[model samples]
Target: MVFLGGGMPWYAQFGCGGGGCDRIRYMKVVLQRVSQASVDVVNELGDLDPTFDLQQIGPGFLLLVGVTDEDGDDEIAWLAHKILRLRVFEDEQGKMNRSIQDIGGEILSVSQFTLFADVRKGNRPSFVGAGKPEHADIMWIKFNEALRSGGVAVREGRFGAHMRVGLVNDGPVTIVIDTADRH
Candidate 1:
C-alpha cells in the first residue's frame, strides 16, 4: 500500500516582479517495513496524514500514524496492537491472511508532524491539529515501547528533527493503517 500524492506541478512562470525560474515540486516517500514483518507506533507522531506518500517495499508493511495533542497511552497501546494484528498480506494458500507478527517483519517508523498539518481556512498550513512538542515527545517514546513490548524490532527515524530519508524498494508492497479508523 504505497501512498502518493500528485503534488503541485511545477511550471515555468516568466515576466513578473523580478524574473522567472524553474522550480521542482517537493514530495515525500515514506517506505515502511517492506523488508520486515511487523511495525508499530505508540504515539500520534507516527501517524501519516492524507498527503503522505508511503510505499511498502518488499514483504513488510508500512505503519503511518497521525499524532495529536489528545493522544494518550491508551491510543499508543491500541495502535501497536492493531499494527501487529492487522492482516493485509496473502498467505501461502493465496489467501489474504497474515499479520505482521505472523511473518516476523521489520518496521520503519517515521515522525511526521506534517500529517497533522491542517489548511482549513488559510493558504498556509496549520499545525494546531498536531500535539504539542512536549506531549508528542512523551507519546513518541511510549509508542515505540509498545512495539518493543509486542516483540517487534522497530527501525525508526529521529523524532522532532528534520531528516533526509531515503529507501530502496524491492517488491514495492505498501499498506496504510490508521488507528483512528477503528473508532
Candidate 2:
C-alpha cells in the first residue's frame, strides 16, 4: 500500500489546532501485510481469548484503525476500495503485483485509537487526538463492512477492549495512511 491512496483508513484527526480530537478531518490506519495474524480479546478478568472467529488468518492484513469526530462515509469508502485493489502481494512473477482481493486474503481489523498518540509535550503520550467511542464505533463498523463487501473474509478484535494481537509480517510490508496527507 502506498501511504495514502491504498489500504484501510482508520480515522482520528489531530486538529490543526486545539486539544483532544479537535477535528481537522483525517483518519489514520496502519496496515501490515501478514503471512498470518490473530487477535484475542481480553475478558473482564483480563484473560486472553483465542476462540473467536478472529482466532487466526492464514494470509492477509492486520489493520489497526482509528477515526475522528468528523470522519464520514466518504473517507471510509475511499480507503476500503483502495485496500481491496492495492497490489502488494506477489504475483506469479514474484513481483508485488497482486491485490489482497486477487489472492483472496482476509482482514483482521482492530480498533486502534492510539494511532493518534501525541507526545509532543512531554515523555507521556497524550491520547487527546483519539475520537470518542460513540462516533468512532460507527465508523469502525462501516469500515469493516466496506471491506467485507469487497468479497474478502473480515474478522475483528473486540472494540475498545484490552487484547493481545500477534502477526507474522509478510515482506514486513507495512503501510501508514493519513487522509489529510493523502487527499
Candidate 3:
C-alpha cells in the first residue's frame, strides 16, 4: 500500500528567506520488494547528495499509508495485521518465511495530504476536500498503534511538516490500498 511521511516544510530551515536558498538536510526513504528488495535513503546534508543509509537497518519493508475520512478503527486494525503478516522476505531456508515481526523491522508512517492531490484539474493540484485534522489525527494514531501492537517497531515523521521527498523505483511493484475499498 501507499505510505507517506509528513515532513517539515522546505522553508522551515530558512525562517523568512525566500527562494533559491541552499537545500536543507532531510531524510527520504523508499523501499521496494518483489523476490528481492532495496531501500534508498538520501540524507540531504553534506556535500554528498543521495547518501545511502539503508545499511544501518535490517531486512524490512516500509508501508506508506494515506489517511482519509473513511479510515477508522476497523480499517487501521485490518491494515496493521495484513501488513505485519505479509510474507515478502525469505528465511534461512530460502523460503518466504518472515513477516515484519520475524525480522524486527519497524515502520515509518507519515500523514500525507498530497496523496489525495487531484491533478486532473490543472497544473496546480487541488486538495480542497481532504480530511480535517481532527479526523485524520485520530486515525493516524490508531493506525500506528495497531502496527505497534503487531510487534513491529515503529517510527514516524512529524505531522504537517513541509518536506522534500525523493524516491527511486527499482522493481516498480508498488501497491496502493484504499481504506474506502474495504467498505
Candidate 4:
C-alpha cells in the first residue's frame, strides 16, 4: 500500500516500502487542565523505580506530547508557548482569562508516542507516524527545557520508559494541538 505521507508504514496504503513520515507531519500535544497530576516512572531495565510527587500545584496542566519525525525546533518552541500561554484557567470573574503563568501553575509533561497510533488498517495500532526513539528522546528533553525556560514549573515522566500517570482533570477541560494545523 502507498501511504500518501512520508514515514508511513508499508501497509498504510497498498504498495509502499520504507521512508520517514511526511515533511508536513505534525507534532501533537494533548493538554488537560488539571487540579492535580503525578506520574510514577517504572524501571523497564529492571533497575530501580521512582515516583515523582513533584510540586503540588493546585491547578495546572497535564500534557501528553507526541513527536513525529518531521517535528523539530520550530514545532517545539511554538507548542511550548501555546501551552504556557493558553488561557483555560478561570479568573476571579470565573472567566477563562488566566494563563498557567498568570495563575502560578505547574506542568506535568509525559512522552506519549502512542498519540500517533494509526489503526486504519486493523485493530492493531501502527506507530509509523511517531518519531524514532533516538530523535524523539532528544525532542522530549528539548520540550521540557523549553517550558522551564518559559518560567513554568515543569515535571516529567521518564521518556521512553513505562510510566503510571495519574491526574484529575479540572473542569474536564481538554484540548488537542497539532502542528500541522497551525501551518
Task: Estimate the Cα RMSD of every predicted model relative to the unseen true structure.
Answer: 13.0, 7.2, 13.6, 5.5
Error of 1 at 169 (Å): 5.3
The prediction achieving the highest TM-score against the true structure is: 2
Compare candidates 2 and 3 on TM-score and give the better one. Answer: 2
Q: lDDT, candidate 3, residue 78? A: 71
Worst 10 residues of 3 by lDDT: 22-31
* Number of backbone-clashing residue pairs for each candidate, in the order shown: 16, 7, 7, 10
Q: What's model 1's lDDT at 17? A: 24
Residue lDDT tens for model 4, 1-183: 444469685555534335433434589999999999887766767543845343344579999999988889999999898888999999899999999999899998999999999776779999888999999999999999999998989988888877777889899999999977666
lDDT of 1 by residue, 10-101 (tens): 32232222233322211112335455332222335655433333322345554444566777877787778877777755689976588777
Sort order, lDDT high to low: 2, 4, 1, 3
The 10-residue segment of model 1 with minimum total lDDT is: 20-29
Higher-TM-score candidate of 3 and 4: 4
TM-score of each: 0.63, 0.84, 0.61, 0.82
Off by over 4 Å in 2: 1-25, 49-54
Across 108-166, the per-residue lDDT of candidate 3 in tens digits comes to 56566666665645699866445567877777778778888888766554455433333
Give the whole-model CA lDDT for all candidates, comma-separated: 0.57, 0.84, 0.55, 0.84
